[model samples]
Target: MNTLFGSNLKYDLKASLVVFLVALPLCLGIAIASGAPPMSGLIAGIVGGIVVGALSGSNVSVSGPAAGLTVIVLDSINSMGTFPLFLATLVIAGLIQLALGIAKAGVIGYYFPHAVIKGMLTAIGLILILKQIPHALGYDVDLMGDQAFLQTDNHNTFSEIWYAIQYYSIGAIPIVLVAMGILILFERPKIKNHKILGVVPGALWAVLSGIIINLAYGVWKPEWQLGGDHLVNIPVLDNLGQIGNLLTFPDFSMIGESTFWIVAATIAIIGSLETLLSIDAADKLDPHKRTTPPSKELVAQGIGNSISGLIGGLPVTAVIVRSSANVASGAKTKMSAVLHGVLLMILVLSIPTILNLIPLSCLAAVLFLVGYKLAKPSIFISIYKNGWDQFIPFIVTVVAILFTDLLVGIGIGMVFGLFFVIKTNFVRSVTLTEMNGNYLLKLQKDVSFLNKALLMKNLSRIPSGSKVIINAQKAQFIDHDIQEVLNDFIASCSDKNISITVEGFKYKIHENI
Candidate 1:
């Protein structure tokens, strides 16, 4: 028990700070993208960290506003016509997530194939890099955390890059290049191994550099300054009395609206899937390889989202960027995740002025490295070496995600994965062995309807005068169609002058025939 709280305290504390640095810009950026109050993302981050972290079984996963759900959330808010009504949907979505947790629906995470999971991570990384490019180059027209291919400005991802290239800021360029350089250097073995340098995370250094450089620009070189649009925009709270003004509760009077429930259900399902996938990814990244209990994670997210909605925050999910940063920062337990939430709350309430000085380009540079780490060329090489069966689905998932949304891409990948599964099952359904003057047919585990054709084809190859033994002792399940095929073959056996013996089939000759 002591170890749970105290183990790796130094690492956890440092890592929590790193994650908080990474999450702050994202929280604000996602809110801007979702068309909600910027403070809403902060509230969600606080709730996700403290509330969800307390209940989650994940050791290193960090939950907050996800870029993946920005499109759904934005559309829901616009369609609902009121922010309070959107809050109502969040509350209902939380309840649905709670119910899903109680029903053990989180087992769905385990069903996603490894190839698809890898693809999802790689795709997310690619999207993060592409989306951050504009912000990193001082073009702030696109929100920092927007992950969709299509932007709010009617421009796509590639088009945004062109815009950034055409209108790059000289001041922002140095910050991004320096931050990226520092982050990349910190990842190197020698730099990381340095005792003094190793203690200071590259993200913290990048953020500090951004703040100092911007402050220096204010004193001199005013014409070459980065604008307010390129800085973190944490809302300044004057007093404790004004806090109540910021929190907007859900309107229960809108319970009769059918659109409310539809939006809630969509948020619940999509949020749960994203959370499950993020946790699975986090667990894979955990150095200790500790497995997270998925059901508990859903309940945690439910509570957090409910609180977030009550306080007028956006929907919350386990975000992989923050989670990956948490793990990479040497977090050993959930304490780091919890501490990050606490820090976010403390900073927003007490020191938001200092946090606001952070340049958006610096944060963009940090995320660029995180994205590159997840989608490195080595990852592609490793996946390719696994052969076409795995590589095809992996590559398809990556391409699909790059073109479409996350959920749709995963759906396409799963369908392709299922096709391969069925194909493999069809080929291996039946085994034929030739014995002296006889043929033995053995059915393996769980025969499906797809195997019926293969079974019939194998049965047709038996010699006219040969004796046949059909074995089903090992098969746990036989499809009704397969049983019917076997029954029809048994009835026709006498005419072919073949003596047949059947084992372990419950079907009676008269009833089946």
Candidate 2:
């Protein structure tokens, strides 16, 4: 563990700090966006980063409140009313995830087609692009930050885009433009040579630029409209004296509500899926190709969520963006994740002012980059190159996801992928020894309706007048459909003056044969 993929404490500390900056606002934004109290996000992030990070076997995978679970969490809180009961559900769901891991259900991921996974990534990319536009353009709808595509008011993703353009503000555009610039310049390898700026992240740069732009708007164009609900405004508490007031505990009375269990299940299922998917991605990204222990991951996640829930935090899971950022930042072990969580706790609880200084728009810029990477063109090209078997499932998944949601899209893709597999296995063959420049096919084993297509194709491919032999040493469960194909072949041989022979096939039970 100390060699190869492992890193020195120096690199891990640097990477953890970088990841901490990257994860902070995301935690707040997703929590705010999910309709939960803004602090719930921070709590989940802290727990995921510190508690789960230490317990998780994953080296690069980072756990926290993910954007993917935002919709579910929002819906759940609204429906359940009593948030504490939801905590109980988190415990139950964690148990389920833990059981799945122990039962060796990690292999369940392999059954998912590559096409479906790509489609999922693409669809999410599209959704992320669609969701962020309102914030990027500076629209100030009351719930503009919520996770549901159509807000609780029934405004779909596209509707929000339309609304944002109609209400687009000039002040917002400049920040995004700077963000765009930061994104571009940071990626160029040549930028590394600039001693001061190299080690610092593009995200920090983009965010700082946004805050500066907002400040300028406030000074010059007082009506630039940068303030209001558009900015992240978590109430700043001064040290340990006020920390208790900032945090809220669950209402224990809701524990008996059946609705609470349902909400918990939703959070657990969605959180587990997203975490597992991220874990899979992290494994692929690991230079050494070390797979994350999935069951262990569930146990860690469960422990984190249970703790987060009890302590007035939102649900938690392994978020892909942070995991990707960790890997990109040269994180080599779970220590980076653990340290990042510790840093988040210290910053939010101890240094609240610095936390508030970071602008929301800057965080949105980071998300834009993450979304783009998730749905890159290169990913599609790679899937297409894998051919139709891979491509069809992938396309189906993408289409399903685009039309429906993540779980539904994956379900549709899996159903079709299974069909394709069964279709491929429908043909059986019999080999033959050379006799007078002709060959024989030995057909045996449960010959059923599945073999019909293959039988017809092979019969047609062979030349007429070619001596053919049928050897069925193990003909059992031979269906009428196969018998019809064999009968046709015999009839065709006679018409073409082709000599044919049959052997080994015996009718043990059927009087009709």
Candidate 3:
């Protein structure tokens, strides 16, 4: 146990700081997007990092308030008539997630095709790049962390980019350029291999640079300085003693309302699905290639969500953005996640004023790098080389996700993936050959109704006076629809002057028919 925690303390600590930086703005952005108190996002982040990180079987996944849930949270909050009632739903949602974990529903994640999973990762990477461009340019019209193509600000992803171009902040450009440059510099072998310099991540330096540069701007270039929505906006508490004022408890009175149950079920199901997908993606990104136990992750998320709700926070889920950031920053274990949570609790409680100094554009630069790694050109080329069977679904998933939301995009990709699977099975299940008026029809494996069309087409092409042999030796199970087709074919064989023989079938063929 000691070895597990101690072996990679240095790496985990550094990675944790990077993840803390990445998560800070996101937690606040998602809360704002959801129309919830900004403190609720931080609470969710802490619970997700500490509670879920400790309980999860995952080595690298990070959890927090997800942007994907913002719409649902916003609509629910308004419809429910109060935030505390919504908090009650979150508690029930957590309980339902626990039930789902106990029922072993995490296995559903494994059913997603590798292509679809890859597509999701690439899609998210693209989303990070496209979405962050505006923030990096200081066009703060849309909330940070909003991933959907259509923004609440009445602009689509592409349209928003155009708008950002027109209204870009001059001050933010220098910060983004410098931060991106520093991030790239840190990737070099000399700096990365250095004993002292390598100890700190590029993202940390970028953030510090952003703070110092902005402070300098305040003194020299007052006209170009960034403030207000351009910087991190976490709520600052007056003191540790007033922490209770920020924490809101769930109202149990709403528990008896049917609407409360509906909202709970929605949160539970969506949260679990997102968690499963994020964990699967994180496992894929792991350098050691370790697999996380999905059911255990669900339980962890459930506990995190329940704790978050009790403390007046948003629902928690395994978030790919933070998890990917954790991986990219060289996290070695779940300790990074836990340490990040600890840092969030300490820093938010102790020095929110200091944190508020960091510019959002610098953080956007950090994500810009992380996004590039996930959706690199080589990844697309590699998947394409695997042939259309894989590439079609992968590309479809990428486009679907780019145009719509994550879950909806995945669902569409799943349908295409499943179609290719069925098509492959249909082709391989049956074979037909004809030579010199002698015909052979072979059922190679389990023949289902899907193969019936091909079987009928083969039968229809046989010429009159042909001698036919039906071979089923390799088939384990033939569908009733296929059996009926065979029966009808046999009944009509006399008119065509076809001679039929059956082999390895379980039932006797009607020779006289």
Candidate 4:
């Protein structure tokens, strides 16, 4: 164990710090957005990182309170009439996830089409860029981690940008600019390769610079100094003993209710889906190309969610944003994820006031770069080159995700992707061709009802006084609808003066025709 973590300690330590910085605001933001106490988000983040990270097979994937579940959390809390009641459902949800893992339902993650996955990644990238613009400009109207198109503040993603433009903060502008500049500079080979400087990730420097800049403003330019909403606001404890006051226990009394079960099932299903998707994405981003066991991931997430809920935390899942940041920060193992959780726990309990001093704009700059990397122009170009079959679904997924929420957008994209699959099968199942004055219709594969329309179209195009051959030698099975269409076509052949020859078909044909 010592050798395993010690070998990559430096990389993991640096990477953990970077992920800690990234996860901090998101935890608070997602909690606030869910109408839950800010501490709940931090607790979930802690559990997600420590519990899930320890149990998961993934090296780079980080689990936490996902922004995707904010709406569900908010609604469940409202309907339950108490946060404790909602916590009860979350515990049940975690147990359901455990059951799903035991049932080997993790294979569902593999069923997602590659186009849709790429689309999801791209969509998230676009969302980060669009969503963070307002924050970068010091517009604190929307929560930091809110990724949906429509905002809780009644402003859509783009509309929020317009609002930000009109009322941009003077104090935040310089901080973000400097932070972004430092981040961009740190990306250069010269700076990144430097032995001493490269030891630290660019995001930390950006955040530290943001803090210093904000403090400098306070001293020399008090009018432009940003505070309150523009900065991180974790609940500070007076001492270690005070931490117990922050914990909220679940109310198991509600478990017998149907509504409780419904909420639990919803959370389990959605959280599992999100976790599977995130882990897949994380694996893709892993430099070593490691694959995480989906079943084990589900089990880990189940345990994490259960523990989080027991302690008054939000439902937990593998989150792509933080995982992406982890991978981007050069994490080598799961130790980074575990250490990040430890940092969150220690810092929140020990020095939350120091964390609160960091600016949101700085984090926005970090996310801006992460988003850029995910949605790079080259990704689109590469996908487009794969032809319309791939590009169409990919673009649809991106657009759908941009307009709708993550699951809804992916569902919409899946519909389009499924259509192409069926269409491809429809074309490959049957073929029609002209030879001299005759026509040959061949069923190359199993023909289903889906091929009925194509068969009809091919049959209708046969000319009068022509001979046609219907070949089904290779087809393993033909649907009843397809058989009916063939029978009708054969019956009409006499009127058109077309002679039909059947080949390799077991079904009875219209011999009289």
After superposition on all CA atoms, what RMSD does each candidate show versus the true structure? 2.5, 4.7, 2.1, 2.7
Q: What does the lDDT read for residue 143 in candidate 3?
A: 81
- Residue pairs clashing in model 3 are none
Q: Please give each candidate's TM-score.
A: 0.92, 0.81, 0.95, 0.92
Candidate 4 C-alpha RMSD relative to the actual structure: 2.7
Clashing pairs in 1: none
Residue 199 in model 3: lDDT: 88
lDDT tens digits by residue: candidate 3, 1-513: 788767788888988998999899999989988999999999999999999999999999999999889999999999788899899899889989998998999999899889999999999999999999998998988888789999987679999999999999989999999999999999998998799999888889999999999999999999889999999987887778898998999988978888999999999998999899889999999999999999888888988899999999999999999999899988999999999999999999998999999989999999999899999999999999999999999999999999998998989999999999888889888888888878899998899998888999988898889999999999999999999999999999889898998999987556563
CA deviation > 4 Å runs, candidate 1: 193-195, 218-221, 433-439, 462-468, 488-501, 508-513
| Candidate 2 weakest lDDT stretch, 10 residues | 504-513
lDDT of 2 by residue, 1-513 (tens): 557434356556756876786677678777777777778888888899999999898988888888667777767777876566555566666666766667766665555555565666666666556667877887746342344444656777778779889988767887887987897788777874356676676666777788888888777887874765567665677558877876666665665777766776777777777777778767666666787888778778877887887787888888766776677666777888999999988877776765665555555666677677667888889988988877788778777765665666668887887776665545444334566668777676777777777677667766766877777877766788877788777766768876777777665222222
Q: Ten consecutive residues with minimal summed lDDT in candidate 3?
A: 504-513
lDDT per residue as tens, model 4, 167-208 = 989888898899889989988989887999998889899999
Q: Tens digit of lDDT per residue, candidate 1, span 452-474?
A: 88898899888788899888888
lDDT of all predictions: 0.87, 0.72, 0.92, 0.91
CA deviation > 4 Å runs, candidate 4:
1-7, 433-440, 460-474, 484-513
Query: Deviation in angstroms for 488 in model 3?
Result: 3.5
Most accurate candidate by lDDT: 3
RMSD to native, candidate 2 = 4.7
Error at 266, model 1, angstroms: 2.6
